[model samples]
Target: MKLRKWAMGLLAAGLLTAGLSAGSPREAYAESKQIEVSFSPVHFIFGGEELDPPEGQRAFLYKDSTYVPLRFASYALGKAVDWDPDTYTVTVREPKAEEKVSIDAYIEERKAGDRPILPVDASALQPITIDAYFEKVNYVFGKRTVQPPAELPGIIIDGSLYVPLRFVSESAGNKLEWDGETYAITGVSTAEGAKPYDEIVLEAEQAFQELVSGFTSEFYVLKSEYDGADDAGREEVLLQGARKLLEGQETFRSEILETLKAKLKAGNYYEGAVDQLAAQFEDKKQGVINLVTLFTGKDLTPYLEKAEKELEGK
Candidate 1:
């Protein structure tokens, strides 16, 4: 779907500002009670326009420590950022569309690197070494310098990582403008783009249907297994859950079919719809598996019957 007119304007402005920062490596970092580190943002030009931010964009601060949502920044900037719970490192990268980037890239780069000059005041805070943090969270940051143990800070808030907004915007060939009054950051790409709305709606419908069907098949399998079991109460509870799934499936099916009919009447081609549906189906397969596991207390094999039957008809 094409971004709304206002959103496009914001993106364009954001990209232009981002492009100007290409000369020098901008220092994007967060100040926390424990430590401070430097980093850069990933940039990209997608379909000749910058992509929008990912969901859940927020900023936070605690005990004078600032926390920025890394996912939104990375997703919006078209960069790859991953957290390793095993190590407390935040991996940030400028990933190409076709490249297979991994979270380990940051750690490898940093390990083969040098320690950075630590700030004087930051030296007094409790030492929360990145290596120690990584051991706690299984995550690592990209190449950067760190101070010695004596100058380290204590208690790192590894939950929310921060970055300079300008770094991400400029790197993506866009501009970032902050509205002080509204506290909103507006990112403007350099160009315009669009996706078919009807197509998206149709695809969403198909995905909803498939998810329902999968759940239904899994529900039946569990029901069959528990049919002659001695735990009558448990069986009743399972049956109720199955009924809910069935009702949900019917509702989802009706919604999708109605939406498709409407789009078809409006002269929308089914190609986009089909493409979206296929994508969604592929994406949601894991989610379906997770759900089945939760309720069935078994593997996903139980849900295969309904999906197989549906596919055969297709």
Candidate 2:
């Protein structure tokens, strides 16, 4: 594993000779006698980017080699480091994912003209090998650039790129913020405010009046026409009106049954009137559903939920 890492550094150096270096690495040969453990200030660079180091620390230097600090170096490069007492093992972990919207889904939504779901530019996204994300640390997103934190600050763990989550979020145009008190992470809202889920849904008890009213009206109207051909286009018109009335209906849910519900709300005797209206409205719903099924060649019964949802915030 050490040899492989060492080879990677050399490969980076080889790229350097060809003007291909983003802190690809090379190791130096050294002897203990020629080393200097000093308080002398020195600035570090990974690729072309500078690294800030702590004061008065040893650089593990020999005449030909220099050693860098791991914890600070990794942190500077947006990686976290941990030490385990059980096995004396050190581990590095990647940053948390900002959001679950996939690149493919983002592209699809963009193509569909929907609101942008992800925060990335999509055009500037670059795919890097795990080694590159870890080893190079420096990167560019479209026109934006990142400078490497320190000398080749990354590790190869099982051949997966574990770049900072910030990189993905930045590539996708997602904004990130830290909560200092709770140490929590948050992504900026894609929408303005929270969804009014409560109004979007009606509990059983709350829905009783509206549901029974809408359903009962449709019922009796069809019953009246049971002995005759549903010729009066009145039923179709009422059903369509009823459907539209329920769409995003919180502010005006009872609009279709407005007069009926108003009477009920006002404690007026209105049972017969509402049932008669609903019965007449039945023909309207049937005609539309039949034609829609014929044209689409599928059961639009599934669309009841859709129609309801469409009116969710309207």
Candidate 3:
């Protein structure tokens, strides 16, 4: 690899390119002359939770920039971090819906390793590799592009890439702060906070209660009108109430149930949480159906089914 070009890439765009020496990489590059680096014990807090670095990896000081393990940092921010050995490319992006399980597994799998660091001395310069570019995925634009960070290039120590901590955290929309005395880095994620399961269930119950109260009030008015009307006019009054109930059912299905489902999916909710919420939604819908039957003195099962089918087609 062209060392000058790679060094320039890191300075401007945070891309670190490097050349791999022949034979076993660690052994072959041990004798190369480079800059001196030091290791410091740095603490990391992400999204209100403390994150411990994997064994045998750490944040180190290089020319005043705090360099963190690239994969670990990206994963802490809830992004999918990947390393391609064949192409020597690192990719960072939003995890796909289907990748949630695999990502969790990967995190657990990376908790252990042994990468011995060379002792700091006059002749020791940390082996730096400037031979990788980051490909950032943007799901909103539906594009996969190689977009380097706008600051310093990353360094490769042992087998891992170390990137500037501030750049990674800010790029992920996190508020980062450092404590000089304690040697700690803390960050707050800007992603939407997950709604509690109880809160979601309570909201659903309240909305369903309101719908029931409004429908009952409208039904009473219709009953009063029917009682005063001639037999020919009474039929129309009952039909109006039935139409209103069916419309209310559709709104409850789309607005309340579906909206809740979307919110649950967006957050880091578990599968059991979604299933429980779904059960409550079904209970609420059935209660509405029963209320409609009692008020109109006619079963609305067929009408509700037909309306749902029409909605699905649309």
**What is the C-alpha lDDT profile of model 3 across 35-124, one tens digit per residue?**
545566556766555566666665676665677777677777667655433344455656787666665665565533333222335234
* Clashing residue pairs found in predicted model 3: 10-153, 16-130, 16-131, 17-130, 17-131, 18-130, 18-131
Tens digit of per-residue lDDT, candidate 2, span 142-180: 233333234322232322222233333333233445433
lDDT, each prediction? 0.40, 0.36, 0.55
| Preferred candidate (TM-score higher): 2 or 3 | 3
Which ten contiguous residues of candidate 1 have the minimum total lDDT?
Answer: 131-140
The weakest ten consecutive residues by lDDT in model 2 span 30-39
Q: Candidate 1: misplaced stretches above 4 Å?
A: 1-230, 278-289, 299-314
**Model 1 per-residue lDDT tens digits across residues 1-314:** 33234433333243223221112212222232333332112222222332222223223322333233444455554455544322234455555554324322322322312323222333333523241121121222233222212222222233333344444333333455544333335454432342333234536665676666776676566666665566775545454544455445455546664565455434422333334444655555556556656755745543354444554686
Candidates 1 and 3 compared: the better one by lDDT is: 3
Give candidate 3's TM-score: 0.39
